[model samples]
Target: MSWLVTGGAGYIGAHVVRAFQAKGIDTVVVDDLSSGRRSFLTDDERFVQGSILDGRLLEDAFEKFHVQGVVHLAGFKYAGVSVKRPLHTYQQNVAGTSMLLAAMEAKGVDRIVFSSSAAVYGTPDVDLVTETTPKHPESPYGESKLIGEWLLADQARATGLRHTSLRYFNVVGSGTPEVFDPSPHNLFPLVFEALLDGRTPRINGDDYPTPDGTCVRDYIHVADLAEAHVVAAQRLDAGEPIEPVYNLGSGDGVSVGEIMRAVAEVTGIAFDPEIAPRREGDPARIVASGELAARDLDWRMRHSLTEMVASAWEARRSAPVDNV
Candidate 1:
C-alpha cells in the first residue's frame, strides 16, 4: 500500500513526498494544480490530477494507488486574502476536507496526517503557545483549519480513524533544491523577491520589545517540518498512539530585523531593511514550545537563522528568472 499526499506538487507538499521517497516508501500524489507546480513533481511518482473536493475522484485515486494513508495538505492557505474570499476558503478547506474524509472512510484508508496552521490560534495572548493554547482564529482560513481538525476528531469518534495535525508558522527554506516556496504572502519569498528585483526589503515594525526591537516569530525549515510528518505517519501506520496535535516551532524565535541582516549577509548584499509602522493586531512576540514534537516526532531546529536564509536564497536564485 502507498501513501497518498494531497497537493503533493506544492512547495511543502513536494518536500513531504521527497521525504517519504527517501525512506523507501511507495507514494502517490493527488493534486489539482491550482497553486501547485507540475515541475516540482517527479516522473517515477504516480500522479492523479484532480481536486480533493471530488469524493469519487479521491476514491478512484485511493483504490488505484492502494492508498493506506493520506497527508491532507490541499486547501486555500492564504490567511489575509481569505478575508476577501471567505466563501472560496470555506469551500476549498472545509468542504474539501469533508470530502477527503468521506472518501477515506469509503475506501477504508484510516490513517491521516493533516497540515494545520498556527492561524487557528489567531494572535495568541501568551508568550509561548502550546497544544493547549486557546483557539480564537483571526481569519476564515484559520477557522477552516480548526474545523478540519474537528472533522478528523468527529470521524475518529465515529470510526476508528487514526490521525494527527501539525500546526506551524512561517515554514521557510528548502529540503531539496527542486522545491522552493513561491508564496507572495510569505516573508522569506517576499524578501527574496525584493532583492532579486533590485528593491529593498522592508520590515513592518522595529520598535517592539524584542532584543532587536522587532517582533519575534518562529521560522522552521521546510525539511525539518517534512521529516516530522513522515515520522508521524510511520508511527500511526505501526498502530502507535500519537498526540492529536503538535506545534513545529522555534522556541527562541527570530525577528524581522535579524532575518534582514541574514538575507543581506547571505546574498552578498549590504543594505538595512526599510522599517515601517507596526501593523494593527501584530503581536510583539508569539513563539511556541516544540518539546512535545521533539519527544514524539523527532523534531528540532536543524537549521540556523543564516542557514535558513542561505538555503532559501540559493533555491530562489537557482530558479529561472522568468519563473518569477
Candidate 2:
C-alpha cells in the first residue's frame, strides 16, 4: 500500500520509512528539512521538500499518489526549547496539525498514526503510565502533542476519521549506519556526543529517590518504535476500531546512573558526568505500560539498553556530519 509520511526525513521518521520499505510498501515523504536532514530520505522513495502547513502541497501529494495512510510525525518536539518558545511551538505543532487535518479532510484521508510523547503524562506518580493516564503536560512541547492527539480524536469523532496515537518515551538508538540523529537532544545521543567531543556530559539531578538518587526513564529503541507504527498503521488500514491512544515503551524505567554505566561500558570511556541541578519540568521517573499496544497492535521493544547505546555510538562514529 502507498503511504504519506510527514517529517519522513527526521530520526524517527526515517526509521519508519525503512520499516515500510522492508515490507515492500511504496511510501512518499513530505518534509521541510527544518530539523530533518534531506540525506535521510532513501533514493527509492519519492520526496517532497515542503511543510505540513502547505495545504496545496499535501492535497497534490494525496492526488498524485495512491495514499492509503498518513503518519503524522512532523512537529516541534524539543521540550526545553518549547518552554522558551511557546508560540513557535504552537504554530508548528498545533496549527500545522490543523492544516494537515484540513488537508486530510479535503483529500478524504481518514486513517492517521500520530507520533505522540510521554511528556503528556507529565510526572506520573506511578512508574508506568497507561493510556488512561491524565494528561498534565508540564512543557509546551508536551502540550502541543496532547493537543495534536485531541485534534485527531475530535476530527475522528466528527468525520469518522480513524486514528492511533502512540505516546512514546525517550526514543534512543539508530536503525542503520547511514541514518542517525547527528545532533540529538536525548540523553544517550548527548552522552555519545560528549564522549566523542572529549567532554564530560552533564547528568541533571542526582538526588531523586531512585537507586543512586538519579532520575529514571524508559528508553525505547528507534527500530522497535518504528515497527510499532507500522503495526498501528496496519490496524487502521484494516478498518479496525481506533483505540485512539497507546503508550509505546519498555514498561520499565532505567536510571540515569544505569545509563551512564552502560555508555561507559559500551564506549570504554572513563569520563565522569557532572551532576547538575534538575531542569525545570524534569520528571524523576516516567515509564510506559505497553499492555494496550500489545493487546491492540502487538508491539514490543526488542533491544536492550546496551544494544541501543552501542548502535547509537556506532552511528555517531560513522555518521556524516553537516555543520550547522
Candidate 3:
C-alpha cells in the first residue's frame, strides 16, 4: 500500500517517513520546502515539491501515487508566530487542510492520520489533559489545528473516511543522522544551539507554580511520536474505528529550567539560561494523557528527556553550520 506523507521533509514528518520506510512500506512525499528541508527525504521515496493548498499539484500527486492512506503534517506550528500573523496562520492551516481533504476525496483516499497539537487544549484548568478535555486554544496556530481536526471529523462522518487526529505536545529528539531540525524554534533545539554557540539559552518564565517555578510541558520524543503515526496507519489498515481525538504525550511534564540543565549535562557545556518574560498565550502546565492512543493504537513514548536532549545535541553538532 502506497502511503502519502504531506510535509514529509520537516523534522517530525521526516521521522515519520523514515519509520514507514523502515518497515519496508512504499511511501511518497509532498513538501513545499518552506520550513521543511529536502535533505530529509530518502532516495527511494518519490518526492513532490509543492504546497498542500495547491489543488492542481495535489490532484496530480494523489492520482500519480494512487495514495491509499495519508499522514497529514503540513501547516504552520509556532505558537507565538501565529499570534503575530493570525490570518496567515488561518489561511495556511485551515485552507491547506481543506484543500487536502478535497483532494483526498477526489482521489478516493479514505484514511488519514492527521497531526493535531496539544495547543488545542490551551491553558487547561486541569493538570492532566485527556482526549475528552475541552479545547480552548490560546493562539491562532492552536485554533487552526483544532479546526483541522474538526474538518477531518466532519469530512469523515460525511464521506466515511477513516481518520485519527493525534494531539501531540513538545515533540523533541532526533530520528537519524540525516533527519534533524536545523535552526529549530523549539526549546530543546534552542538550548542545544545556545550551548553549541557558547551563548545563554533564553527561558520564558521563572515564576510559574511548578516544582521549580518554571512552566512545565510534556516533552515526548520525536521518534516515539513518529512511531505513533505508523501505528495509526496500521490501525486504519485493519479497518478499526477510533475516537476522533488521541492525545500523544509522555504523561510527564518537565520544566524549561530542567531542560536547560539536561542540555548542559548532555553536551558537557556550562551554560546558564537567561530568564526572559513569559510569552503570552502560554499555559503554566499541560501534561497530556496518551491513554486513548495507547489503548486504541497500541502507541506509547519510549525515550527519557535525557536521551531526547542528547540525541538532538548530536544531530545539531553533526549537521553543517550556515556561515555565509
The Cα local distance difference test for each model comes to: 0.92, 0.87, 0.86
lDDT minimum window of 10 residues, candidate 1: 315-324
Q: Regarding lDDT, does 1 or 2 come out ahead? A: 1
User: Which window of ten consecutive residues has the lowest lDDT sum in model 3?
Assistant: 315-324
Candidate 2 Cα outliers beyond 4 Å, as residue runs: none
Best by lDDT: 1
Q: What is the C-alpha RMSD of each candidate to the true structure, in Å?
A: 0.8, 1.4, 1.6
Cα lDDT of model 2 by residue, 28-109, tens digit: 9999999888777777779988999999999999888878789999999899889899999999999999999999899898
- Spell out the clash pairs found in candidate 1: none
Q: Put down candidate 1 lDDT per residue, 1-324, tens digits, no spaces.
A: 999999999999999999999999889999999999888888787898999999999999899889999999999999999999999999999999999999999999999999999999999889899999999999999999999999999999999899999999989998767778899999999988888788889899889888999989999999999999999999999999799999998888998888888888898988878888899999999899899999999999999988888888888878876665
Give the residue spans of candidate 1 off by over 4 A: none
Per-model TM-score on C-alpha atoms: 0.99, 0.96, 0.96
In Å, residue 295's CA in model 1 sits off its true spot by 0.9
Displacement of residue 204 (Cα, Å) in model 3 is 2.5
